[model samples]
Target: MLDSDYTQRFLFDDTDVRGEWVGLERSYAEVLAKHSYPEPVAQLLGELLAAAALLVGTLKFDGLMVLQARSTGAVPLLMVECSSDREVRGIARYDESLLAPGATLSELMPDGVLAMTIDPTNGQRYQGIVALDGVTLADSLSNYFASSEQLPTRFWLAADGRRACGMLLQQLPADRIRDSEEREASWQHLRTLADTLSAEELLGLDTQTVLHRLYHEEQVRLFEPRSIVFRCSCSRERSANAVISLGQQDAEQLLAEQGGAITIDCQFCNHSYRFDAADIAQLFAGAGTEGPSGTRH
Candidate 1:
């Protein structure tokens, strides 16, 4: 995987809605390394990662956006989180014994919901869920946009061994007197061109080149790119704070049973952090001296 990749936000001057295209290579590789996932599961995650970035980048929201799938099948759950800064992390839960070699989402996950959560840094969190309504990740996402946003949207996602990429086209909201029929005609033409895109082209072609191939007749404005990277918000201090939150008695008992300190492992990145007896003691002592402090370690 490469270090950090870029997500480009683009707008059609005549269309009401904005869109984004993101290609992830190294970031996706880092996320896939968190666990041993089957090929289907890995591919699902790559598409989900690209989709999550697309949604976040398109909205231009200063919040955390999450894409999650939960089901009562072999692949029970999968989720990816992306912040406005383009930091990303994800994980999947599955029945290893039941994993098929190349199960599709319909085969492995079956009935499920694709959920999106937007947690604004200063405001409330909003969530929207859509039925597993389409054949692939991109179609499901387009269905979500139609249902939730009432906007005509399209997604094209593709991944090979080396990189994963996705492109989105959306019809923005328009004014009453803007000749809606003309806009619709343009949209129809653009959509037809977009349909010509193949998986190989999506993953292999450069961003500008792809756009040119699809929308050569349209007036498109490409925004400044935002860099995306694999970033896990896990650390020893966070783990220690979690232990402290368990209360001194419970924490100490677990430590004693385990023979020493408490060990915490992050599910997203598989990073482990351990706190020794001294660390625990210091934590409780500080909490006592600081007068019921709500501070994190």
Candidate 2:
């Protein structure tokens, strides 16, 4: 049986080109279940999630990778977060009334900026910014890697309403192939094979079949697959901390204004956390020992 929601890493045994394959089924459905997003926004979000997983798999990191885009068009914001552990979540901000039925990505996000942020657990955070210049998300990312990174990288991303999938192939630093011409040839050869993969095959086939179909002539070593999970890191404790950060005066004032429990809803998961007067009292009673603030800088 094929792994449906797992990300697998593979290396061309004879060359410096490495690739990653990610398929999101249950994880995709879980993200869609959190909100009733329009088709275009949903599709873009799925592609972002898939790309994030693929990048995290390619990079060596211990924390999180964020793919974010900001626009002044119909869709204002698209964000996807993938942890080193393959946990992924995504969200998109859009105006349904402004969307045309067949609006292209450029129309949806005109003059947008795409950014990739790698936040490590023990090191400094790094971010790469580029223009959203391509028709698809994959194009922009591939450009980022090729130009900003100065590395030959290619990305094939696909997402339907039901499934999100992606593959990434990147040429590593000079190792086995030291000659410039040989490295270029190898990179082009691998990319040529990868370009033959269609969106349908990517979304429909399993990892092994996909790899074999693409690189059967080459020596490839497949790594153990890592499962992708849909998870919101929000918790009641965090929500309560947020409430506490508002200070007692404002907290009580809001409670008075509402005439009932103060509800804090998580935008990512749409889960509401309510705190009543008594609950607020208990929270403050414990806040002295916890800290005066709970905000992250």
Candidate 3:
């Protein structure tokens, strides 16, 4: 499966902190293939992709989580969504000329705020918004976790558009402790070692290989790997709802102006859904039970 992506989460038997590692290469290629983003846009997308994966690793939820930003400056919007199953999709809406090659998130989205939303398959949607004061994606996300979860966590995320990577280390409250300072000291020491991990090592090494190289002295237990892939939740029926929101008159007008047919394309995945004369007729003419239009039957 080309979707079989990179990420590793582990627990240390000696410490009360959990850790995770994630990387991306061809997985990013899948998303980049849809658009010709500028260098900064591509790099930002990679960071978002890595951030989404890090959130997936940290949160306890069985649904999709989306990280997005709406800016009033160079980049209008950037979205990165990942499901519980590790299916990821991302896009960046930006003006190429407004940003430079090595622009940071604050530079690109000057007055932007970061937001995180959770959409369960069968539950209420949850969302959170935070100010963007941090200089980098990892910094902003760390601020989000500190404010939202009130947890002491660390995140190291990196990417080059072609590949993205991340590592998360978090403190878990312990019941009994002989030396609280020792635990903190151990975590600090471990993070120092993890800090040395380079983007190349993260993107190129295997889970155990990287862990051994970083924390070979500690007792680390690696979990079974979970796969990741590019999956878009958009469908023709959903697209039809979009067209319907345009109202029957406007839809018909667009249909009439475009030869009695309308094509709805999903911006997330570039998948197009076509609605013809019969589809339009059946949609508005028949009983409401007849789904939106062009639903895969």
Which sections of candidate 3 miss by over 4 Å? Answer: 1-4, 176-180, 245-247, 257-259, 286-297
Error of 3 at 158 (Å): 1.4
lDDT-better candidate, 1 vs 2 = 2
Cα distance off (Å), candidate 3, residue 30:
0.6
lDDT, ranked from best to worst: 2, 1, 3
Candidate 3 lDDT, 127-184, residue by residue in tens: 9898876888788888887898756788777777778878888888864334889877
User: Which residue pairs clash in candidate 2?
Assistant: none
Deviation (Å) of 35 in candidate 3 = 0.4
**lDDT per residue as tens, model 1, 104-218:** 6777777888898999888889999998757888888888988986578898888664677898888876752268788788777777888899999988887889989888887
Per-model CA lDDT versus the true structure: 0.81, 0.88, 0.80
True lDDT of residue 95, candidate 1:
86
> How would you encode candidate 2's per-residue C-alpha lDDT over 1-297 as one tens digit per residue?
655788999999889999999999999998899899999888899999999999888888899899999999999999999899888888889999999987888999999999999999999999999999888889988988876956678899999879999999989999999999998999999999999999999999988899999889999999989889998887778888898899988989998998857888877778877777778887888843232333331
What TM-score fits each model? Answer: 0.89, 0.92, 0.87
lDDT (C-alpha) at residue 100 in model 2 = 92
Q: Least accurate stretch of 10 residues (summed lDDT) in model 3? A: 288-297
User: Which candidate has the highest TM-score of all?
Assistant: 2
Model 1 C-alpha RMSD to native: 4.1
Error at 106, model 3, angstroms: 1.9
